[model samples]
Target chain A: MLYTFSEVLEKVNNEVKDLKFERKPYSLFEPIEYILEIGGKRVRPVLATMAYNLYKADIEKTIPIALAIEIFHNFTLLHDDLMDRADKRRGKPTVHIKWNDNTAVLSGDAMLIEAYREIAKSPKEALPEILNLFTDTATEICCGQQLDMEFEQRLNVTTDEYLEMIRLKTAVLLACSLKCGAMAANAPESDADALYDFGINIGLAFQLMDDLLDVYGDPATFGKRIGGDILCNKKTYLQITALKSPETGKEMQDWINKEVFDEQEKIDAVTGLYNKLNLKGLSEEMIESYYQKGLSCLNKVQVDDNRKRELRNLAESLLTRKS
Target chain B: MLYTFSEVLEKVNNEVKDLKFERKPYSLFEPIEYILEIGGKRVRPVLATMAYNLYKADIEKTIPIALAIEIFHNFTLLHDDLMDRADKRRGKPTVHIKWNDNTAVLSGDAMLIEAYREIAKSPKEALPEILNLFTDTATEICCGQQLDMEFEQRLNVTTDEYLEMIRLKTAVLLACSLKCGAMAANAPESDADALYDFGINIGLAFQLMDDLLDVYGDPATFGKRIGGDILCNKKTYLQITALKSPETGKEMQDWINKEVFDEQEKIDAVTGLYNKLNLKGLSEEMIESYYQKGLSCLNKVQVDDNRKRELRNLAESLLTRKS
Candidate 1:
C-alpha cells in the first residue's frame, strides 16, 4: 500500500502531464504547458506524498493536492524568472524568453488560479485548513521574493537575514506541503506540526546545500551553468560566510567592490576568496546542523520508525543529491 | 439599523485605510499602499455590503469580506496596468508607473494572497462557500483577461464573444461580491443566487457604459483621457458593433486599418463613422437593456421593497453617472 519515493514522484509526474489546459488561448496556456513539461525534481509533491504515506496508504487520495503544490511552485518560478531576468530554466528557455513578459505574467497568474482550484478539490472537511495554510505559505513566499529583490540592492545582508529570506522563499512551501499532506490523511495535530518542523529543517538544509552546490558542483552533473551565483553576485551562504569571515573578509569585500572586471575573473576571484576562507567547510557544517535538527524533528513525530523510513531516506537523498 | 450605500462606502474606505501592511519591506508593501490609496469608487465592496444589508443589518460583521473584495479589485488593476502598459489609473500614476514593473507584479501577487487571507477570516461557517466562490471568480477574471489579450490580436471578434469576454473579465467579480455578501449573512441560496444574477446584469451595463463614456463623455468629468480606448484600438462593444454593421462596416474597417494618422483626427474619423452608423443609440439601447434586466433581477429577490431600496437607488445612480 505504501509507495516508494520514486513511485510517488512518478504519480506526481503523471498527474502533472494530465493537467488540463485549453489550447484555444495558445498564448496563455502554451507557456503553462511548456513550463510544466520541463519538470523539476517534483520535490515538493514528493515530500507531501511521502508525509501522507507515513499516515495513510492511499497515495491516490493526495495526488491532486500534491499536484497543487507542484503547480504553485512552478507559478512562482514563472514570475521569478521575470524578476530575475533569468533566460534559461531546466536547460530550456525561460517562459518570458520563450514567449514574452506579458504572456509569462498572465500565464503565471492563471497557473496560480489553477493551483487553488486543485486545492479546493480536497475533501470538504480538510478544505478550510488546507486553504488557510496554503494562503499563508503563499504570502510568505511573496515576502521572501520581495526580500530577495531588496537584498540585491544592498551590500550588508547578514547571514541571519539571508537565512530568513531563503526560508520564506524556498523552505515554507516545502514545510506546508508536508504538513498539508499529513492533514490530508487526517493525521493528529501534533504529528502534523512535527512534520512541518521537520520539513522546515530539511528545507533549510536543502537550500543551504544548494548554495554550496552552485559554486562547488561539477558543471555536467549540476545541470546548470556553474559560477552563475558568483557572476551575478547573488548573496548565497558562501558569499555571506566569506563576507563575515575575519580572515578573508577584506579581500572578499575588494572583489565585491570592484566595478570593472571580466565575468569569469570575478567568479574565479570570488571562488578563490571563498576557498581561502574555508566557506565550503562552513557551509557543510551549517547544512549538517540543519539536517541533524531535521532528523530530531522527525524523531518527534509519533509515527513508527519504520513508517518514517521512506521520509528519512528521501530527505537524505535530497541532501546528498549530485543534481 | 441598515447602512445606506454611502455609509457602507465610508466603512469600506475606513477599513481599507486600517489594513496592516508591514512597513519594513517598503518596496513590496509601499506599492500596495500606493495603489489602494489612489482608490477607485470601491464599487465591488459597496455592492457587497448592500447585498449583505438586504438580509441583515449587521454591517460590521461583513466589513472584512468587503475589504477582501476591494483589495482583490485593486490587485487586478495593479497587474492590468502592467499588461495593458497603461501609465495612469484613477487620475494618478499606475502602480507600475509609480514604482516599476517588477514592483507591480510582486506586490500584486502579495495583494492577492492578502485577499485570500481576508477571505479566510470570515466566520467559520461561511468560510468554505466564500472561498469556493472567491476562487472560482478569481479564476474567471484571469480567464477573461487572457481572452481580452487574445481578442486584441484579432479583428473578427463577434458581439457574443465580446460579451462573454466582458462577463468573465468584469461581470463575474461583481456577481461574486454580492453572492458572497449574502452568504456571509446566511441568506437563503435562492436569494444569494438572485443577488448574483442582479450583479452580473449590473456589471455588464456598467462596463458597456464605460465603453460609451470613453468616446463621448466629457474628459473633465470622466477623470481620464477621452477617446483613449479608440486611440488604442481596444475592441469594445461599440467598435465591434460598428465593424459588424453592414451600413458602415467598410469605413469603420478603413479607420481601423489605417497605419498612421493624427490622434485627434483618428478620434474624429472614428467618431464620425460611429455617428454615421448610429452607434451611440445602439450602445445606449444595449446599456438600457442590461440595466432593465438588472432591475428585474433585483425585483425577483424576496426581500421587501423597503429593504431593496438602497440597492435600487445605487444601481440607478451608477447607470446615469456622467463619469
Candidate 2:
C-alpha cells in the first residue's frame, strides 16, 4: 500500500496547491501563497511522507507533517532570500522583491507559526517528540546561517568548517524531516535513528553535489549559470579543497583577491585552477564516500528491502540530478 | 500558597536573567541575550504566572510557559523594531541597529524557536492547548502588524479597523498569556475563557492608555518624547478619531499633509486641535470603558476576590501610569 516517490510528491504538490489561506490581512497571507506556489523540489516533505509510508500504509496521517516541513522550508528561504538580498527564486521574484522586506519578515514569521500549527496536528502522543526535533533543527539552521555569513568575511575557511556549515544549514532539516516522519508512523526508535543517519549522509552528499555542479555542471542542464559559485567566491567544497592545494592555492587566492575583473573571466580562471588541481575528482570521491555511508545507514533501518526501495531510488536520483 | 504579582514578576525577571546562550555561533545567540538583557516590563510572563497562580498553588510548574510568552514577546519586538526601522527599544539601540538587520532577522527567528522549545517543556497534558493558543496568537500578531503597515500608507482607516489592529498586534498575546497560564494550571475552561476576556479588554485599554499618554501626558513623566505618534503621523486611535471629527477633521488632515513644519510647532498645533475637538476626553472615556469591561471579566473568574486582588491592582497601575 506504500506510495512510490513520485506518488508522494504528487500528493504533496496537491496538498500544497489545496492549502487554504482565507485569512484576513491579505498582505500577510498572499506572500505565503506566492512563495508556496513558486515551489522548489518539495524534497523535505516528500522525504517525510515517504519515510512515514515506510512504516504505515495510511499516508494521510503524515499530510500535516509534510506541509509543515514544506512550509517551514519555504519560510527559511523567504527570510534567507531577504538576508542574502536575492532577487529571484524558482525563476520568479522572491518574496521581499515581490512585496517588501517588512512583508517578508512578517510573512516568514507567520509561516513558521503556521508550520508549528500544522505539525501540532500529528497524533497527540507523537506531538512532543516531533516538535522538539523540529525546534532543534530550526535553531541549528539559524546557527548554520550565521556561520555561513561569518565565513563570507574570512578568507581562510577550512574544509571542515565548510562541511559543518552545510551540515547545520542544509543537512539537518532533511534528517529531521525523515525522523519526524518515522516518529509519526510510530516506527521503532532504532529504525528511526537509522533513517535519520541515512538522511544526514544523503543530505551531505546532496550539498556536495550542488557544489560540484556549480563549477562543472553543463550550463544547459544545470538550470543556472555555471560557475556562479566561482564568480561569487563562495566557499564551496570544491573551492575550499582547491585552496588547500600546495600547487594551485596561490593562484586560487589571486583570483579571489581580484578587486575588479570580468565575471566570466574570473569564473574561467578559478575553474581552470580547479581543473588543474583535479578538485572535481576529489569532490566526486567525497560525494561517493558519503553516498556509500548513507546506504550503509539505510541498511540498518530493519525494514524489508522492498519497503525501502523508493527511498533508495530517491537518494540515487538526488546523487545524479542535473538541475 | 499563591505568589503575589510582584513575587511572580521577580521570578520571571530572574528566570530571564538566568537564560544562558552558550551555544555557538555566538553571533546568533548574542543579540538574543542583548535584547533580553535590555529588559521591558516582562508583562506577558508575569501575567501568565499570575493567571496560573489564581487556580494552582504550584506556580513553579508555570515557569516554562512564562518564559515562553516572554521570549515570544521579545521576538516580536525584535522583528517589529526592524520592520518599523525603530532604532531604540527600552532606551537602548535595537537589535538591527546594535548588530545589523540580518542579525536581527536571524536572531529573532532563533528566539522564536527557543520560545517554542521552552513552551514544549510544559506538563505534557497541557502542552497541546497552550501551543495551539500560542501559535494562533502569533499568527494574529503578524496579521495585525501587516494591517498596521498597510494602514500607514492609507488615510481613511476607521476606528473599528484601528481597534482590530491593536487587538491583534498588542492585545491577543496578553490574552494568550493569561489563558495559557490558566490552561497550565488546569483551571475550569469557563474560568480560562473569562481570564482571556479580561486580558483582551485590559490589553485594549492598555494600548489606548498608551495612545493617550503620547499626546497629553507630562513630558517629564513619559519616557519617550511626547507627541511621537503625531510627528510620525501614525494611525493610532487618537489620529483616526480626530480624522472623523467634523469640526477639526480638516485641520487635522492639513497637519498630516504638511510637507514641512517645525516639529514642536506641529506638536503644538495638533495638541491644540485635539484640545478643541475634546480628543483627550474622548480617548480617556474609551480607556475607562475598556478598563471597566476588563474588571467585569475578571469578576467572573471563579477564583476568590483575594486571589484577584493583585491582578486588579496591576491593571489599575497600568491605567494610571504616565510612562
A221-250, model 1: which lDDT tens digit per residue? 998777888887888988887887888788
After superposition, which runs of candidate 1 have C-alpha atoms over 4 Å from their true positions? Answer: A23-26, A250-264, B257-260
Per-residue alpha-carbon lDDT of model 2 for A1-323, expressed as tens digits?
98999899999999999997889988789999999999789999999999999989899899999999999999999999999999989789999998889999999999999999998898799999999999999999999999999998887899889999999999999999999999999999999999999999999999999999998998889998998789878889878877888988888988888999999899888888889988899889999999999999999998899999999999999999998
Pairs of residues at least 3 apart in sequence or in different chains that clash in candidate 2: none
Candidate 2: interface RMSD equals 0.6
Separate clash counts for every candidate: 0, 0
Candidate 2's C-alpha runs over 4 A off are: none
What is candidate 2's CA lDDT for residue B24?
92
lDDT of 1 by residue, B1-323 (tens): 77888888898988998887884566788888888998788999988888988888878888878988989989988998999999988779898888888988899988887888788778678887898899889878887898998898888999999999999999999999999999999998998998999999999999999999999998889877789888889999889988888886888788888899899998998888889878899899999999999989888898889989999898888888989
CAPRI class of candidate 2? high
Give the candidate number with the greatest TM-score.
Answer: 2
